[model samples]
Target: MPRQPASFLPIADALRTRIRAGDWPVGERLPSRAHLAAEYDVSPMTMQRAVERLIIEGLLEGRAGSGTYVRTPRERLRMVRSRHRERRGGSPFRSDMAEQGKRGTWESHSQARVPAPDGIAHRLAIQPGDHCVRTAYEFLADGMPVQLSTSWEPMAITDGTPIVLPELGPLAGMGVVERMRTIGVVIDTAVEVPRPGRATQEEANMLGISVGDLLMRIERTYYDADGRPVETADITVPDVRWEIAYEIGIEQPE
Candidate 1:
């Protein structure tokens, strides 16, 4: 193994970019650590740090009997949701994004507008056939995928807003709570439900793991001041690299 003198973050970021760009397509096996170490001209430990960072972000998963694999959008989002639930009274998105951006050097990994899937349609509380704007992004922090997010907004509402043309100009931030503000829908509260299960093929493909791996599923719905369901987000997090801690506030007894 060689030392780059440069930090491992850049190496990790570049590797992640390759994956996001289809250099390492979904379900594709990556090279061994020794190979990666040689390719990046870094020590094994430094390469390990880069891999660990992505693992912590729920983008990659390693198995006792198998190698690492790319995680799915669902698993990545679940990690973000779990962390958001744990941290109270602040902007969870900003905190998470800032940390993640620092890792991958804040480069855009992937973006696309696709039709919402069935599960997403149900969560958004829209009709089965309704169309929505779906955007998926792989964000890296310190050169790894720390966050994988997919956002869906009803075309009916967003079509009228500047968000309709995201590539043309700057719109709202990635978070639904923040994005809603652009449409005069302020999110004052969020309710979350958490479920646990084995990872599916789709999840395994994205997170770079095998099916049946442990995963945490989180469903979050945002509400406006008038109690309207403004947005719903579903997230799946791999159990290996990510964990959420919660603190509850208690009132003093009289």
Candidate 2:
């Protein structure tokens, strides 16, 4: 077979080099695809592919009727998970942001008596048909979305209690551990498991990020002293936007 046209890889590498060398400073528009293709000695489609790769990496952004330009780098924030903050005031996220010298806020929508789905049922250790309160939240720092969450709590634990609605009453915005206290439920332990994931279209919309971007998902469950699961939540953060950290003290052996 005859030699085929050069692939987009070499073109991408050349463009990447130019970007890093500051040949085109941030906010400077890249030449049109046809122009770039002629300059790089590649087909316009190949050149377009190279620019798209850069766009996904957040190195460049495209504007309608305008060319692509270098993107401004955003500073990634730190999200700390220090167990001690569970005892402090406000929500857990608020405490974390405070420690990072930022203001935190959240918006939540809750549905009462919603039937538990299979995934939520498993997390709460309850039957699929069990009644639960489902809450979806978007948490932000200084008006920029940083986290997204969906939580479910079995009504069997808080039904008919003043703390049924998580963001309501005098206990509003108080972390789960404290809100459960009003109903005589002594939450003794919590568990969290985090894994890598890709942002869904909805998640990306909520977090103001691109779809298919990396995300860190944390599955968390709160338990009463009796070892019964009381509530469960899925917390997701854009991987490029935050540095997740954990702190635990070691036990000294005698």
Pairs that clash in candidate 2: none
The TM-scores, one per candidate, come to 0.54, 0.81
Candidate 1: stretches off by over 4 Å: 1-91, 97-122, 165-168, 172-174, 247-254
lDDT of 2: 0.87
Model 1 lDDT vs. the true structure? Answer: 0.61
Residue lDDT tens for model 1, 92-122: 5456646544423222222334466788777
RMSD of 1: 13.7
Q: Which stretches of candidate 2 lie over 4 Å from their true place?
A: 1-17, 26-29, 32-34, 37-72
Point to the candidate with the largest lDDT.
2
Candidate 2 lDDT over residue span 1-254, tens digit each: 99663487678778988998999999999889999999988888989988886776577899998889988755677777767778785688888887778898999999999999998899899999899999999998888888999999999989998889999888989979989987899888888999999988898778876666789999999999999999999999899889788878688999
Tell me the whole-model lDDT of each prediction, alpha carbons only: 0.61, 0.87
Worst 10 residues of 2 by lDDT: 3-12
Top TM-score model: 2
